[model samples]
Structures are given as structure tokens and as C-alpha cells.
Target: MSDHPHPPSFDENILKKVEALQEKYAAMGQDLNAYLDGLLHADYLTYWDYINLDTLLSLQHPITPFPDESIFIIYHQITELYFKLALHELDQLNTSASKDPDLILKRVSRVNRYFEALTHSFEIMVDGMDQDQFLKFRMSLLPASGFQSAQYRMIEIRSTSFDRLLREEVREKYEDHAPGDLEELYSHIYWKAGAVELATGKKTLTLRQFEVKYDRTLLELAENTFEVNLRSLWNGLPVAAQTDDLRQALRWLDTNVNINWPLSHYKSAVRYLQRDPEDIAATGGTNWQKYLPPRFQRRIFYPELWSEQELANWGKGWVEKEVFGVK
Candidate 1:
């Protein structure tokens, strides 16, 4: 018969992959042919279905009729998504047995990129909203402040030593504390002061609500990440492996998160809430004046990474330039 030899069922590479997959499934006590049959019958994946696009679009149900509230909701949703990406990078390092400095640098670089995006994009929150609509609708969503973001708190916990997160006034008291002392330390966590009711000297309903939902979970994460958090990992790195690029990334991350981000919020607060007679109280009575400025918190994730003068001048220049239009 005039014919080329019948073509082999699959090319050599495909056949090799199938063989490897069969071996893999056999090790796991699976029937490879059954899995192959399921794959053969499966529908082609659509982009929207793969990403759950319809479900994601349906999540925003603004509590008030004000159209600007929709902007607020969507922007916060976008922020949480970015935070999720940052944590995903950190979690890989935290869970891995390898303390390879290059891996840490790679993940840190990715996280820094995410925060840079967030810091730049915060202009949307600052200037995009109709302040009148925002102030009107924001009250309807009272006691529920952006201060209640558990993911932001989780980023702090995952980023550095828990002691670094303590209020400056109380941090010295717990300077020599042990791991079991997390409860006491957490009680004085810096952000809590920001969430207090100005007149009553008590925790705001916003902070109280957040504590109920996240206290145990966050404490557990803190305990688990104690040895594996970014600061600890950086400290553990051999001096030779601590490249200048890595140091720069870490420093940029600290500035982006602690200074630039808070100042961005401060800018938004002044834009909407600052008034002629008396500046408006923020949602949930958050002490924005006390809370949003970096000079007050002075929360340095990596103290050893800075000079004494740098530490003294922390958050000062950024605040003057961004908040006050200083040169």
C-alpha cells in the first residue's frame, strides 16, 4: 500500500508527559485513565467563569443611595484585593522551610510593587469623590470606618515584630516581655488609640466590632508568624546575602506602608472632613488628627535599618510635602 507509516498517537513529548502524569497518579493511588477521560469531556474554560467575574461584580451593594458611596465601596474592595496579593507573597516565605534570601527579596519586591500601586492610586479616593455626597452618605454608614480593616492589621502583623506595633507610650513597658505576653501587648497596639472615642476615652464601636471578628484569628497569626515574619527573616539572613537591592526594597516597603499610605488617608480626611468652625469627627470617631500622621505613631518596622537622624525625621518630610503643600 502507498502510505506513510501510520502516525504515532501522540508526539514524543506529549507521550512522555502522559507517562509522567500516569506515574504521578499511580503514586497517589489514582486511576490516570479516568482522570484523562474527565479532562477529555470537560468544557473549555472561559475567562469570566475562571475568575468568578459575575459573582465579584455582584458584591457591591452600597448602603446609601449616594452615587459617590459606590466609588468608596469599589476602591476599598480594590485595596483589599491588593492587600490579599501582598499577603500571598509573604505567606509563601512564612510557610517555606527554605530561608533563602533571594526568595525573600523576590517576594518583598513584589509586595513593594503592590503598595506602590496603592499609594499612587489613592488619589482616586482623595480627589475623585464629590465631597458633599461623600459626607452625606458616609454618616449613613457610621461606626463602620475604614479603621476596621482587619487585612491592614494583618499586613502589619505579618510585616514586623509585634512589639514594633505597640503604642510608643506603652512600648517601653513591654520591652522585655516574652511570647506569652501577646495579649497584654495587643491591648496597647498603636491603632487602638486611634480608634478611641475622643470624649469618652473608650474604644470606638468600630474597634470593638473589629476586635470581636478578628482578635483570636490575629493573635493566632501573630504567634505563628513570630519567628517567620519579614523582620525576623531579614535579621536571620547572613550579612553577605543582605544585598543592597533587598535593603532598598525593605526600606521602600516601610516608607510606603507606614508614611505614604497614612499620609494619603490624612489627605483624604482633610479634603472631606476639615471644616471652618471645627474639623468634623471622622467616621467611628477615629482620631484622624492623632492617628493619620506618621510622626505620632513613629512605628518603624525595622529600627536597625535606619540611622538615628533618619529615625528622628521619620514621616516628617512626607507629611509636610503631601499634607501641607510644602516644597
Candidate 2:
């Protein structure tokens, strides 16, 4: 005690933590001192750095001089981030070993919540931007369109079997191939029909550019998710887990993605771009009148879950009234 000053009595909690850390490192074939050295050099994490606030705020590089252009960029970036979040949940659903119903419901709920947010906020696109500026700036973005969003495509792939996402005609055509053939499966996806030239029925520059940039990656993703998609995973759940609540949740998710979101988006297009007599073509040069409306596409993610009437109704009456002003 006199020589070493009582050896500097340590707190019991601190001593216990140190001993636990030493044992943990020992079991892992590491030295606690080596980790302590690294910790000594580590910088304290800041909120800005932890969230990458600076880099995230720097992403909105609008081409035009209009202030609203930044809004457009930022909103799409936000949407993509939401899509990324949804994909994170989907990935967890796809990889889970147990296929726990509670977990699946939780994840699908998250994805639906994200889509619901987008659906509700699509008014930002319809009304937030000045029409004149949006029209003017849209010309600067020639081939790039929301249709080109690869993450959106990935979400669809993870949500259902590729066959369900295809037009029945397209599905029948590819029925000869092995069920999981990536190239064949993706060839029939419904979105391939979008962004086409109405006059010539050829692929639009928008579609061509999208294919060039994403076709390979999409094929790979489709291959990976072919058997593990949301519908397949849901079918794998215990019969008790397919309760009415869960069924309604899944149905809402299906309609949110395939109908409600698209319908809202189509309304925005109509609001901004639908000039009477001859509506302005979309920036992507598609027959968006045909492409954007859900009734014409009828892209259902889960077919067996819906009855004949629901399938027949699809996106019919409500969409016609809201989007096209039909009686």
C-alpha cells in the first residue's frame, strides 16, 4: 500500500468489463491490447458522419436552372432510398431460414408502408413543381424516366414469381424454358412493354437505354430471387399464418404497388402533362396513356389470392374515373 499507493483501486464494474473483454479476445485468438490500440486511434462518430448527411445532401444535381428541378431530383432520390429500404426488408424475407409468419408480416408491412408513403406523397409530383418549369426541365432529361429506376424493377422481382409479373401471353411463350432461367424469365416481364414507341411499336430510346444499363443485373437478380420471392415465401408460411389479416395485408401490398401507386403517379402525369386534344408525350417518349394506367397493364403480383371478380375488376372503374375522367 505504501509503495504502490494501494495499486490504484479499480471500480468493480470497470474491472469486470476489462476481464470480459480480455477473455473475449483470448477466445478469438486476439490480444486485447491490439484492439485497445485501434480504439485509441478511432474517431468519435458524429451524427453527420454516421448519417452521411453531407454526401446525401450533395446528391441533388439538377441540370436546369429552375429551383423546382432540385425538388424533382430530391424527391426521386428520396423515393429510391425508400425503395432501397423496402429491398432491405425483402432481402431479409428472402434469406430467412425459418420463414416465420410474424417476421414475414413485419417485413411485408414495412414494404407496404413505404409504398403507401409514396402513393400518398405523389401529390408532390402533381402539384409541388411549377408546371412550366417541370415541362421545361423535363426536356433536358431526354431518356431518363422513373421507368428506368432499377430499384423499382428489383422490388417487383422480389415481390412475386416472374411468371405472375408477365402478361399471360408472354408467360405462355416462355413456358418451354426451365422455370428459373434468368434470361427467359426476365424476357417476359410486363415492364418491358412500357416506354415503347406507339407509332412504330419499337422500343423507345428510354427503354433501350434502360435495357443497356440494367438488363444484365436484372437478369441476375431475377435468377437469385426466382424461387425465394415474396409470393413463394408467403405460400411457404404455415396455414394458420395465412390469416385474413395477413391476406388483407398482402392484398393491400399488391394493390399498393400495382394499382394505387401507379394510379396516383398516372394522375400526376395527367395533371402536369395532359394537354387536351393532343396530350404531350412523356419525356421518355412512351405511350404513357396506355403504359401508365393499371387497367391496361393489369400487373398482378398474386393471382391465386384474388377471386375472379377482383381479378376482372383489377384497376378498372376507380382508375377510369380518377385518371381518365371517365364516368
Candidate 3:
């Protein structure tokens, strides 16, 4: 034999794979040879091409010429992308054929990881930009606000019972409301309060635009995930699989999304928007004081996992230490 191994022929593994592909294409009435030819001609994917990096980089078209405006735009885009990843994990769990607690634990942990990454990266917004640049460029953007992030809303809608997302004021009233009344109940969703004009107590143009675009989609998601959401799924799981680790994972998720995440935003708001007794309105005219603080919303995803004290204190410690500097 030559020093090199004999030129390879179609080995058993290669032949088996080819046969499998042939059968796969045959089942769909496709010619495997045609696909093989196309595959042969296709260029190998590069990192940039695979991710559309150029397209993604080109997306941040700031309305103003300020350099920091790009930072603001890119950061929000990144936040939305992470929210999409979280929703992807939730979607898989919600639509799964079986309520596997291990899967729930795995997916929820993944969402937690995404949120933690976001919470840490939020430092970019908190300190990276010059406040003057952000304040000026933001004005040119008009009634658009991060509050309009539909994916974030979808994540909440798919996380728990629809009523959990409603404000405490109307939640009791609408908790038992029929599915047919989704639209009516949505009218009182907690986030709608976040976008009101502080002076007038009226819907800001930002909220109106968000509602018009997302209300139907959010309602549909709420209905579809009604029985399959995390809270409902946990309720239906067998006692054996409802392990302590799983409960802890969910509690972490609840804290990550509701408490830690919002407090980070509230921290940033205090950095950029906080003034003495009179603070500046956010670009979208949102009341950042009321909106960013978790103590105000008190939104929780899995309540049964938390105790009365935890619920009562909800986000109070973080606000005290980070925002108020009350060591």
C-alpha cells in the first residue's frame, strides 16, 4: 500500500448518509441528484453572510447626526434581539407536546441567562452615552419608546396568566374575565399606564402607536398560551417532577424579568432623566418615574413560588441600595 491510505471510496457511513438523503428526498417526490447538484454549486457560508452582519450593522439609522444616537439605537436593537431569544425559548415550551418539567427547567434557565446578559449589558445605556447627546437625539425620534417593544410584551403574555400583566388595580376585576373579553381586558394592561402623558393622564402618542400595532397580536398570543404558559404548566405538572430546582429556576426568572431587569432600567433613568422634584419627561413622554420602578408595577410571573414577604418587598432592596444609596 502507498504511504498514504488508499484514496477513499464511498465508505459505509457516507453511503448510509447518502441513502438516507435519497430516501428523504424521494418521500417528497424530489430528485436527490438535483439537490446534490445545487449543494455542490452553493458557496460555503461565512460568518458575516450567515448572520447578515452587514445588514444588521446598517439598521441603526439615527434620525439625528449625534454620534451617541447610534449607541442608543444599537443598544435598543440588541435588547429586542435578546427579548426575541427569550420568546423563542418560551414558544418552544408553550407548544411542546408534553409538559416535561426538565424541559421547562432547561428553557426557563435559558431565558434567565438571556435576561441576565441583558441586565448586565444595560450598563452600556446607564453610563456609555453622553446625557446631552441622548437628550437631544431622542427628541428627533418623536413618540417612539422602548416601551413599544412588542417582543417584550409577548414574553410577558406567554409567561403567565394574562391577568398577571394587568395592573393591580384592574387585575382582580379581569382575572376571571372570559377569553372572549381579551380585548376588553387588554385595555387595562399595566403597560398602558407606562406610556401616559404625566401632565394630562392621557395616552401618549407612543402608547397609541404601540397599541394600534400590537394589540391584536398580543391578544392572540394570550389566548393561545392560556393553558400552556409557564404558570399553568407548572400547576399541571406531576408532583414528582415539580422539584425544588425547578421552582427556584422559575423564581429566579420572576425576579430577573420583573425585579432585576426593571430596576436596571430604573437605574439608567435616574442617571439620565432624574432631576430634583421636577424631572424631565422621556422622549416618548413616558413617566419614567412611574414606569421603570418595579415597586410601582409589582408584576410577577410565578407568584406561588414566592412568599408573602418576598412579594411585599418586591424590588424594594435593589431600589434602596442602587437608586437611593441607602446602604
Candidate 4:
């Protein structure tokens, strides 16, 4: 053996080969680009040119000269853009659900992921802006709040029955004609179904019973909608490929149903309260904690999708558990 181990020799040939491959790849990319240019025509390029990145970026308006305000504005604006994109995707998904329920569920699950990202992003924003800095701009945002976000409202309206009821309640509070047309339509369907059942010597249902039945039917429809999506993902698969996408989608829906929106609303309220305590009393809006009612806590959008054991495993303690606190 030699006194010192010989160092490994550098392979100049190997280095040369790597450089040659890189050049070849670069040339191939250029050729591919030229081919794509020929295929894509001038209209696509003109459309691309129409995109005004500068104008889009100019929308960030900082009310205060505070350094953090810039950060705050950008972060929230980014979140709103994300919300817009998610709403677009959800709208498409909802349309698909009307036809291909399975595909829609997958898309809805993806949208839920976006919501999760937004929730986490808000937490980050809270951390970045100290209490004092947030207070400076908080007052500037008076009546204009996330509650007035049309896209958010649209999402809630399209996704849940809650919006319909809430709208009706608002209309009733204003002493306006109650828009019970939907309720009436539901009643008509239920009565028709009941008549068929009665003719077949089955139990006849009252209007109230029919309403409950309608609710259950809608809930089942939602479940079926979810299931159809889950089944599509499970298609073209062996046992191993059938992963927990369905379970994850269900969990996401459960989270949204139980906590997501309320949690965000609560956070927004808390941040506002932290900045201005007096505003809470003046505005007649309580702290975020109070907003989470017992009913809201236990709300599940698609309870039938979950089995008894799954509910127990999730520590939800059955459907009857109150919202604010464990019963």
C-alpha cells in the first residue's frame, strides 16, 4: 500500500459530456419554442400582451405611512385574489356536480385545500402585523369588511342551504314578502311524493314532515354528490391505489361545516377588537368567541357521509353536541 491514499482523478471527459448534453438540451428547447410559435398564431400572443401586470400591482393602496401597512395591504389583496380564484374553481365544480358529481367532489375538495391555505395565511398575517400597526389601518376600514365580500357570499350561497334561510330571515325582519317560493316548491314535491306513497298504502306525511323529509333528501343528495366524486377517484385502481382522498374530502367538508368560516370570522372580529375595543360596543358586534353558537359548532353539511364510528373517532361525540362547548 502507498504511504498516502491517492486522490480520485477528476473526469474531464465526463464534464465535457455533461456540458455537451446541456447545449443539446438548450438547442432542443429553442426548436420546440419555434414549433410552438408556429402552432399558436398571433392572436394568442396579442391576448398575452393585453395582460397588464403593472396596472394590477398598482391596486395596493396604503392608507397609513406605516411600514407594516404595505405588508398588510399586499397580504390581504393576495388573499382576496386567492379567494377569487377559488370561487372561480368552485363555480366550475358546482356546475360539474350537476352533471358529473364525482368530478365536482374532487374539485370541491381542491377548493377546500385553498380555504385551508387561506386560513393559515390569515394566521401568518396576524403574526406579521403587530397590534399597534394593525390598529392604525383598522379604523380606516369602517363599514367595508370581509362580510361584504361578494365572492365569499356567492360561495356560501352556492354551497349551503344556510344562505337561503338567512336571506329569508333578513327579508322577514324587514317586513318584506317572504320568499317562500322555494319552500313551496319543496312542499309541492313532498306532497306529490306523499300522495304516491299513500296510494301505495305507505304512510302519509304532513307539510312539516315533508319539510324534514326534504331536508334529509337534500342532505342525502349532497352525500351522493360527494360519493360520486370519491368513486371516480377510486376508479381505475387496485386496493392500494384507493387512498384516503374520500376521507380527506370528508374531513375538509366537516372542517368547513364545523369551524372554517366561523373561525375566520372570529379571527377578523378579534383582530378588530384588539385594535379598537370601543368599536365593538358601538358597532353592536360581540367578540368572535360569542359568534360561534352551539348549533353552528355541531353543524355537519353531510352527516350521512360519516358513519357512527367515524364520528366517535373524530371526537365530535355524535351530531347532537352543541357548538360553543361540549355537551
Candidate 4 local lDDT, 100-192, one digit each (tens): 435545667777877777766666564677666666566565433443344543444345443122322242333222234344332322122
Range of the 10 consecutive residues with the lowest summed lDDT in candidate 3: 276-285
RMSD in Å for candidate 2, one decimal? 2.6
Clashing pairs in 3: none
Candidates 1 and 3 compared: the better one by TM-score is 1
Ranking by TM-score: 1, 3, 2, 4
lDDT of 2 at 316: 88
Tens digit per residue, CA lDDT, model 1, 124-160? 9999999888888888888888888888988889888
Runs of candidate 3 exceeding 4 Å displacement: 1-8, 27-29, 96-98, 276-285
Better of 1 and 2 by TM-score: 1
**Which tens-of-lDDT digit does each residue in 1-327 have in candidate 3?**
579988868879999999999999999999999999999999999999999999988898878889999889889999999999998899997565649988899999999999999999999999999988877777787777788899998888878888889988887787676678778888888888887877788888888899889888898998888889888899888899899989999999999999998988888888887754333644455576777789888998887898999999998999999888999
Which window of 10 residues has the lowest lDDT sum in candidate 1? Answer: 276-285
lDDT of 2 by residue, 1-327 (tens): 266556678899999999999999999999999999999999999999999999988877889899999989988988999999999988876576637777777888999999999998988988899988888888888878898999998999898877777765776566445555757667777888888887878998889989999998988877777668888888877798787767877898899999999999889888987775333654544678888888888888887799999999999887878777889
* lDDT (0 to 1) per candidate: 0.86, 0.83, 0.86, 0.49
Q: Pick the candidate with the highest TM-score.
A: 1
